[model samples]
Target: MAETYPVLQEAEPFYFEGNDIGILVIHGFTGSTQSMRDLGEAYAKEGYTVCGPRLKGHGTHYYEMEQTTYADWIASVEEGYQWLKERCQTIFVTGLSMGGTLTLYMAENHPDIQAIIPINAAIDIPDMAALQNERETRFLDAIGSDIKKPYVRELAYDKTPVKSVKEIVMLMEKVRNGLHKIQCPALIFVSTEDHVVPPGNSQMIFDNISSRQKRLVQLDNSYHVATLDNDKELIIEETLRFIKRS
Candidate 1:
């Protein structure tokens, strides 16, 4: 018999009502709402309506993710955004890792989005063709919890399904091709020592986006999952500051 895995309560979706400025927080691929929970709570405490949706097939198990695709993941964010649109007059979007990619995609498609904040967004990746070549392989060691801080936790699958990685690569390609269409104000965060995604990926986004008001902030003490790493406060503070100034 196959072992069973269920989503943890803390990894489930969360929503908090606050002010008119709603923030749609998105977590990375293979990661649950747990990764974005604290960020959402912080924004809510500051009087911003916040929602964190668990991405499709995530926070459950690798087998579930193997059956999913990037479109399914984007639908999760769209659902959250639609929820916000009904209540809030203004909507601000923020996402970490693959969440960032979806945020950029959203900004391109949704001109009504006031601003976008992409933290370590995976717009472009290294050697994506090679990854697609190995899609038939079962799994690889998980890179979802690549945090620099000790004892910090990010709820993610233990193994990465290679087929799912192929879908991620496909998403990156689509996001990169549409980067020039992202005209909304964007604030991008990149960690100097990221292990899962190279710094060049962030650079490519900063270069390609057509946003007139954009800034790239670099983190010194964090890794890939900066939201769960040493620089988390920096992310929260900087994001709030950007929202105020935007």
Candidate 2:
């Protein structure tokens, strides 16, 4: 069995509220809180409080995750938001992939976020019409039986719930229709050739968000996991700039 990660019964505060800056790192679907672990440490070292919460139904069996909905995941983020609110007066949200989508969702409602950084976020998931027609494809069993790839893209041992995936695609549609309402300082990063998330998602967000301070940086190396990809530096640097500016 794989060893569990920084096992914690309660959420860990990344820093003190008295410090004036805090960060909440949200992980992607089917991914554990550890996806933002390295970034959390980087924030903590820089004297900012950071908390990366495990989304609902993650860090365990994949098949068991099917029961969770997007709302459940949002609740987890809300809990982190409340927790960080206690100590840090200002909190910035950042996420990878599905995590990024959640961050945007949170920032949409919570304007207290100083800045929102989306790493490899898909504002719109392409091939949705195609995916809907092919939902019955054997993604789970194929995922389960296949050996872990050498590229360190090992999934969280969780299965993708078709319903959950459907919900994500639906959520993307909702955001696309209401992008004008999001007015926070947004920083979006896109992988030119990301296989999982189409590049247009980032473009749409960059083009639609009403914030003048927003920026979109293109990444060539990191596929979907910009947190751990070769162009991860650009992520850290750009994020740091947003944190400092906000």
Give the winner by TM-score. Answer: 1
How many clashes show up per model?
0, 4
Q: Could you estimate the TM-score for every candidate? A: 0.96, 0.84
What are the clashing pairs of model 2? 15-49, 17-87, 62-158, 62-159
Q: Per-residue alpha-carbon lDDT of model 1 for 193-241, expressed as tens digits?
A: 8888788788889999999999999999999999999999999999999
- Candidate 2, overall lDDT? 0.71
Model 2 TM-score is 0.84
- Of the candidates shown, which would achieve the greatest lDDT relative to the real structure? 1
- Model 1 has an lDDT value of 0.90
Lowest lDDT block of 10, candidate 1 = 127-136
Worst 10 residues of 2 by lDDT: 141-150
Residue 58 in model 2: lDDT: 70
